[model samples]
Target: MEGFPTVELSGRKQHHCAPLCLLHFGPEGKMMPIAIQVQKCKLRCSAELTELLLRRLSQTPGPDCPIFLPSDSEWDWLLAKTWVRYAEFYSHEAIAHLLETHLIAEAFCLAMLRNLPMCHPLYKLLIPHTRYTVQINSIGRAVLLNEGGLSAKGMSLGVEGFAGVMVRALSELTYDSLYLPNDFVDRGVQDLPGYYYRDDSLAVWNALERYVTEMITYYYPCDAAVEGDPELQSWVQEIFKECLLGRESSGFPTCLRTVPELIRYVTIVIYTCSAKHAAVNTGQMEFTAWMPNFPASMRNPPMQAKGLTTLETFMDTLPDVKTTCITLLVLWTLSREPDDRRPLGHFPDIHFVEEAPRRSIEAFRQRLNQISHAIRQRNKCLPIPYYYLDPVLIENSISI
Candidate 1:
């Protein structure tokens, strides 16, 4: 309100107005709102002044930008969060600057931008940076511990986009660190249920699944290869049994309810088994050798076996959906660039005709024949461009 001072201009011919602070003079020098305000320019200062007031109203603090914990007190604090977030939302240069300058605000902005849709280009940008940091043992440990204060940041990255990163991070930590503490185990397993509820969370799960699935398919031999490690083989079989049994039972939940998890499970199962079969059926070791190139790993033998079974079981549950999705994926994956990007042109435009009380089957059949004859006739006789047909002529000719 102090900044929102009003000014008064009387019956005077003037080009410019006085400073706002001067106009609010009152009795005994106390300030008061001016009865009338004059605009220096014909353009409305009212809108401009209103916007300025709004900006002041929306001012927020800089710290605690990423995590919007409810207890944030100052307006400036929330504002800082939005500012940092939008900056990161807009430009990579802003991210680089923030990282280089240790601008927590910029980092906060970057993390906040992850809340955008998984398909958004911004997700792709931020995901790679996380992967780069996760590869290092020290940074990854910090990430796992949440000491880096990136829980929201981690959650923001899309799952599929971050598949490789997830694999590397989870694998490295699993292998190099002490056994997951009871707390970590408890938190992780509990968090997964919630994670699997959201569609975006499925992306992360899918990536992890892909790695696990591929690993099992490559290593697990189809022809009694379980002889080398009978224990490992037994675990795999058990996992597969449990997964399949759960799916077959009435206890299994609807896919829509646990969509994210189901999607992840499906990807892992399908890809892993498919990869395995590809190797075995082709008599090629390509899939097995290519394992290290993927974004994740299998830390424990039991977990790996279970992951495979889980994937396979999940895949079994969504046969039709899986087939359709895979066909689309394959078409998209195999499509030629530029040409493939063009939409299909072969589809016919359909028009639904409403039934009339007086209409007969014979009349409908006759109309159909007429249309068919017209189409053939036009194809044979009219070699002109499609656009050459006059609208009036078409309307007259097509009239029933």
Candidate 2:
């Protein structure tokens, strides 16, 4: 079976390879002409090594030929070959492509492993110069959060450095962003086909908000030792100060706003939900009466989005808020654990899903219709008062 090409690849060999083509060695010492032409001829006898080599070669600069891989054979390898060979293809670009074109659950499993770093050759080819849209997995998000609390000596410093880089990248990316369809495909998902479908202005903003919330919950270090360390504290303070000061600056690129907004949102969410997420950052976290062990049925936290909640309540007041709210909900819904998720499972949809706890779908629809009625009026966008959120904050804090 062969892999196919969707977009043009770099170098002169582009034509020789189809976007979808399979490259496998045939019987004897000779190379088989799969979807891609074999040039290196460094065939490995081990099937595991052969697949790895083939996948890597396919990503290499190819000729001008349109490469085509028969879709039927992507998962056709013998069961015996699955174990040894699967791990080696961890960095295979085709895996992401396969996920976009086929099974989402499988793509999700691969994404959860975090085996492929953003620096992988395929990543460079696919997401070049794009840092605003990060590829996150549960493990990757966990590592960033360090939910285990056992931070070793060198790990904290590495995390801090990475966070610094991310912060700068976020503040530089544009707000009125355009996403190529291939970017979604690279992330192992696809958007609905339409001009408005790929437009992510709302998703970008929601992602920034959610990211900020995550940072507040997970990334901020709170140990006295960490806070006491002048160097580390200085870094945190400097970054935070920069974010606050530059937050509304017109000079800041919309592209980069997502990053800072995410950092800020994370800060607020952590402050609201569990101070522990911000424990390592502020060193002021105290275990309060609100902390308690939640049941397994509720072990996974339900979706929480302030923007979406606000948007829903004031829908009649603002038309743009409808689009923004739905987009926010879509972005928020994607990050929920699969077991706890509703519709808008992985991407955007025309209709919004109700995320409130204990609400029936019909009831949710009625409520949404009421809000839509208000939005249709000439009402203007109004800010959601902060006082009303205290109970929600307390509830979330206790659950954590």
What TM-score would you give candidate 1 relative to the actual structure?
A: 0.17
Tens digits of per-residue lDDT, candidate 2, 105-222, equal 2221233224334433212211211111133334334542343311111111123322332343344432122122334565443543322222332232233244333333233334
In angstroms, the error of model 2 at 322 is 51
lDDT score for candidate 2 against the true structure = 0.26
- The list of candidate 1 runs beyond 4 A from truth reads 1-75, 83-400
Worst 10 residues of 2 by lDDT: 293-302
Candidate 2: segments with Cα more than 4 A from true spot:
1-400
Give the alpha-carbon lDDT of every model. Answer: 0.26, 0.26
Global CA lDDT of candidate 1, please?
A: 0.26
